[model samples]
Target: MYRDHSVGVVMPAYNEEGFVGDVICDLPEFVDRVYVIDDCSTDGTWDEIREAASRDAAADDEPVAETALLADGGDSALSERATIGDPVGRVIPIRHRENRGAGGAIKTGYLAAVGDDMDVTVTVDADGQMDLEQMPRLIDPIVDGEAEYAKGNRLLYREFRQDMPRFRFLGNSILTFLTKIASGYWKTMDPQNGYTAISGYALANVGVESMYEYYGYCNDLLVKLNAKGMRVADVAIPAIYGDEASSISYPTYIRRVSWMLFKNFCWRLKVKYLVLDFHPLALFYVFGTATAALGVLGGLWSLYVKYANGDPLFVRASLSLLLFLIGSLFLMFAMLFDMQVNEQKEVQIRE
Candidate 1:
């Protein structure tokens, strides 16, 4: 066990037959349990998982321990037996009857982690893009209490440029910027990077089952964490892009991320401002929105009156321009103040 913690790795898979074995095999020796959640893959992925589980058991320093594979229809009893039996030789795999997307599968693993009383839960995709060797670095911060959640930030470090595509790089940059504003984790980068670890307390408190099921999962989780007042930290790591095609389509991501931003912004305003009594930024946002709307309406009315010869063109135009400028300036200043307020909050927490 690394640093007196019961560490578990959650690998969510769907049709990952080609590299699932390699992903499982590459996990470090210190990990206590590797939970593989096969999200109803039609290919031989489940068969490969079984093969890998057996191989992993035999390759351990000790054999002859009872192995539990897939928990026989989500049985927690089997999970406990496989996890508690031997630290070295047992493998347990949990299978889902219906396809529940990757996020849902990881939620199952999170439930297992909590039920098993695991100290830490690490999620790495079964697609084999993540570097298993960096697992310890990701686990260290949470184990040390530096942060409740630690995530990989591929853009801040140099190794990320090796295999990353240009379009993906740009898109990730845009999403990360929006996530910082929405999630209040302004210090974080590469917000879409999925390799992450969280303490059992944070995971249990955040309620993983409620997280979004598709591409918006990570960003939504970040927003949920911030709403709970949990700390989030980022660790720089290398990027891996290969022959495997990403199942996340561009248009789907754009639509989902946009909607998630709107939802989280509204939720954060209600929770952090109205419910929790944090600050007055929410009031400022409201004022800015109202002022901007009024300015737009007045400007349009003035233009219509002037064009219809109902008023002096120069006087109406001047008044309209003045109102628009004031409203726009108020909104801009409000946004700037919000950024500063968030930055100060982070600094205070660090101190």
Candidate 2:
């Protein structure tokens, strides 16, 4: 245990047979449980998980901790034990009957972690891209009561930025800005990064079951956390790019996640601003957006008419420009207010 808190690592595996085994073995001994969920990969991923669990169990100096591999129908009582009669295993391998996407698999592990009453839950993908050594940085803030959730930010350092693929770096940058607006965490970056740690309290309160079950799950979770007034810290960490290929299609992912963020933003405005606290920023956002759209459209049409018929119509053009300026000012002030309201949430836990 680290700092007298039981740590549980949630590993979500797809077709990562080779890398998954190594990841399981490389976990810090301080970790009390590893919930490795296989998302119904057609490969030998399941075998790798069991083999690695058995290997870890055999090599343990202390008695292996009791664990159950939930495989039968995904929820039935431990029907197929990895090792019969020997319930003491650190790695608890759970398999899904069909693919539930990465978020779904993590949700399964999350629920299991909540059920077991783990002190902290850390999510690390089974592709072996995340550095096991940097885990302490992610956990320190949560353990010390500084933040409720700590996420790894690879883009925080210049040297680390060179390691990421150029396309991914640019795409992640765009998503970062969009997510900051949607999640209401203006100071936070790298919304796509998966390496993160959360306290048990956060897990139970973040509405895990209703979390987005797609590539944008991390972004969606941030919005929920912000709405619930949970503290989030971004820890500087390096990215390890390797042989494992990403399954995501960037264009489709960006589009879908963008739409989802918009919906979440609207929901947050109503729930947090109107329904709960009743902040004026919500009005600023709604009216400002409507005013901005009207201004842009009016300005364009006025310009077209002026050019088409040589009609000066100075009054119309000036009025359109004025409306746009006012709208822009409203939006700017609303964002400032939001940032101030959530300034405490984006903690600076640089460890």
Candidate 3:
């Protein structure tokens, strides 16, 4: 265990038969448990996970510590090592009766990890895109008490920027911006990146069952974390793309997640600024939104009046522009106030 903390890895697999075995076998030896949740794959993914578990149990008596696969440039004999040596950790395979989305699978993993009393839980995708070697970096912040949640940021490096697909990179940027406003984590990016680690304390406190169970789960989780005043860190990680097909449709995904973020933003304002502890930023937001709505409606009414009757529209235009300008300024001030209040909430990692 790193830093005397019990570490666990949760892999959510959905028809990832080609890569699930390799992902499981490559986990670091320090991990105490591995939870593989098969989300009702139509393929042979469950069979592969069962076989991996059988191999692990069969080799319980072997002294494979030194020969086991190391995260630091290990040999490519994964299948052989997996079948003939003790696994890095106990593999607990869980299967869903029907296909729950990625978020649902992760929730199942988190519940199991919490139940096992693990100190830290890291999420690794079953598609083999995330680097298992980077597990330590992801969990270190949580272990060190620097952050309650740490997530990989693929956009930090130039090579990653070039490696990610253009469409995905653009979409990630937009979502990241919205998440910053919604979650109050101004310094964090790559909101859609699923490679992350969370302290068990934070996970348990966040109410796993109430979290979003769809593709926007990551973003929604961030908002909840912020509402609870949990610290978050963004660890730089390289982007690794493989032959795995993406299930997301960019247009639909962006629209749906955008709406989710808007709702989450409102919810955060209500819970954190209004319900939990009163803050003036909430007033700024309410006044700004109301004023902005009135300004837009007034402008539209003025335009209609101008077309319907040959009346002078200068006064109406000036009033509408004044309202719009004032409303925009108030909203800008509210955002600045929010940033100032949350600046200290960010997780500061000491090297």
Candidate 4:
């Protein structure tokens, strides 16, 4: 119940029996409801949750005193009356029938929060990679009407140099660049960062029908929100790296990320140009691609003709060079304009 709003924390777990209880115990006490979602774990995760819930229910029913003092200055100790109180545990554990991946677990948590009518839903990984102490700071902007979604940027961490993985560091950098182009949030860094908090209104607005279910979930959500005109803001949060093992394979990683990138790019073209009618950027992109393709084809044809004739190179060389140069310049300018437009959009939102 921070800032007049009920905060719900969702921790998605799968085969996380050892760490699940730790996560539940570590969550802040002020969180009105903490939902532990077991995405069909094969281990004793369900049993652990049941045990925790039972213990919590018992604690909630513990006896507490309620006393009223008289105006006659009665002793403070004797004026109180003991009454049975609600358990200290407000955490609820939910289990899924089958495996739905991390994204699916998140969607489940989100739907639950929405049903509960919570003011905000904060998604925290069950592996405990994110700092729980920074939860309030991440939720503050959304609560204050400054942004619809708030994301944590690990690179902004003051001590990012300490122990961040090299591969993850490089992968995040490349993906961030590509996602900015696809999602139109050029100002955002670490688009793959999943430590995010969203306002209830925004969550409801972002319908879950077409949400991603794999590793691409975070990036896909960013694009969807951008297309829906929801503003996303980044908050500085430190990275916590430990024994968490990543199960992502290179082939699967490439396929998922490529599909998401293409989907977002096409969606952006359709919405920003056709549906919204924002600017001429779409036309420029189309024209640039066509011109560049034509120029490449023309150059190849000219070279073939010259090879067959074994004659004058003047006509072929001049036309090919001219078209290639003009097409390349046009394509470059189009990309530059797209970047500028995206930057301007971010600036306007901030202002």
Please name the candidate that would achieve the greatest lDDT relative to the true structure.
Answer: 2
Segments in model 3 whose C-alpha atoms lie over 4 Å from true places? 56-89, 348-351
Cα lDDT tens digits, model 1, 144-219, are 7777888887776665654567887777778888887788778888778889898989988996757777767788
Please write out the lDDT profile of model 4 over residues 126-225, one tens digit for every residue.
Answer: 7768889988887888888878888888776646834656776777777888887788787888777788888888888887556787777888888878
Regions more than 4 Å wrong, model 1: 62-90, 158-163, 296-351
How much is 277 displaced in model 4, in angstroms? 3.5
On residues 52-165, what C-alpha lDDT tens digit does candidate 3 reach at each position? 767665555533323222333223321211221234337777766567788888877776676666789999998889988888888988988889999988777888788778
For model 3, state the Cα shift of residue 230 in Å.
0.6
lDDT tens per residue, model 2, 186-273? 9888888899999999998989878898889899999999888899999888778789999999888899988999999998888789
TM-scores vs. true structure, each candidate: 0.84, 0.91, 0.89, 0.80
Output candidate 2 Cα RMSD. 3.3
Model 4 local distance difference test score: 0.71
Residue 106's lDDT in candidate 1: 73
Ranking by TM-score: 2, 3, 1, 4
For all candidates, what are the clash counts? Answer: 1, 0, 0, 3
How much is the lDDT of residue 339 in candidate 1?
Answer: 67
- Candidate 2 lDDT score relative to the true structure: 0.84
Best by TM-score: 2
lDDT-best of 2 and 3: 2
